[model samples]
Target: MFVLTMYVMLLTLDDYKPTYQDRLATPGMMIRPKGNALEISYNSEDTESWDLYVQALDNFLAPYNESQQIMNNKDCTPNTYFIQEDAGEIRNNPKRSCQFNRTVLGNCSGINDRYYGYPDGQPCVLIKLNRVIGMLPGKDDQSPYVTCGAKVNYSQPLVAVKFLNVTYNADINVECKINSLAIANPTSDRDKFAGRVSFKLRINKN
Candidate 1:
């Protein structure tokens, strides 16, 4: 049985100190990690509605409910998102709010910048797909049979790129689906095998 799991964690370039770029460390400025750590698990019998990434989103930002729910949570998406929904909110709240006058979220001027851990609102993230313990779906037939990145856009963020394709994908938005990916159910949503690939997201400052 081949199972795929993904890590969803938050880190600053100075704190996490990953072996690669810090892109995979955070999904977006709005989304936070559960206990500052999270992951997505899947196999073949999952459903599209049962999105793995969405589930992770809930877990990651579970502690910061007040603002996370209001500004970033899908449930609160229906209503208007105020830059000051929780202006005075601190510690487990949206770190970015013009009303709050907080630089904890970094520099809003960098918003949309191709850098992670930046206060820029561009929502850049880093991903480190660890080596799968077992054989991947479509892997080489040699000793080092490993896995690679897969197609999980059905639940991935709005714009995922600089890795395989260019930074283009209108679908990624504030819907909270920006950081999640659809479950990999066999046949129906059988995207990529999470077991084989381990890569860091590429950030192009251009």
Candidate 2:
């Protein structure tokens, strides 16, 4: 069985108090540049790690945008915001984390989660952010700190996953593993099973 793990770092920024012309400079950019951007990095050892990470990130961010809308009490519907995913693999186990850094336009807060699939067609894993590792920023902090983790029986294979946002950046690294049970009896006519996949996600401000 193949074991996959991933790490991601995210950057959070707030206080986009830019002037009208400054905002006009980039009319359509989703994240306005107003405050310092938080920098987050994720690391993983398994191949296909980045794919899972991106999937979770997409899932997490979609709701985050909505939460922001509710907080602002604006007439806007919570919609998916576009993001760029740039990731790479590290041969050395010591350097197996994905890095996310950006300057956000407004005040936002949230947490991130990691998800992945297991061998033997088991359910997907859902890693929730624990208080120790998944704490968000308080109402009066510089920026919120995101947390991440996994749940064993809450993962599934990537057949046709739906993401709320359009991915502007993405990177994938994958490694395949043979199913020992399937290999043991070639003539058994059992379906071949894929290895496993893992992911990371960040929460949006509330």
TM-score for each predicted model, relative to the true structure: 0.18, 0.18
Cα-based lDDT for every prediction: 0.26, 0.24
TM-score of candidate 2 versus the correct structure, residues matched by position: 0.18
Error of 2 at 75 (Å): 2.3
lDDT of 2 by residue, 53-129 (tens): 44644464453355554553334222222232335642222211111221121111112222322111111222222
State each model's C-alpha RMSD to the native: 20.4, 23.7
Q: Output the lDDT of residue 131, model 1.
A: 26
Over the stretch 124-173, how does candidate 1's per-residue lDDT look in tens digits?
Answer: 22222332222132323221121224222111111122123323222221
Alpha-carbon deviation at 165 in model 2, angstroms: 19
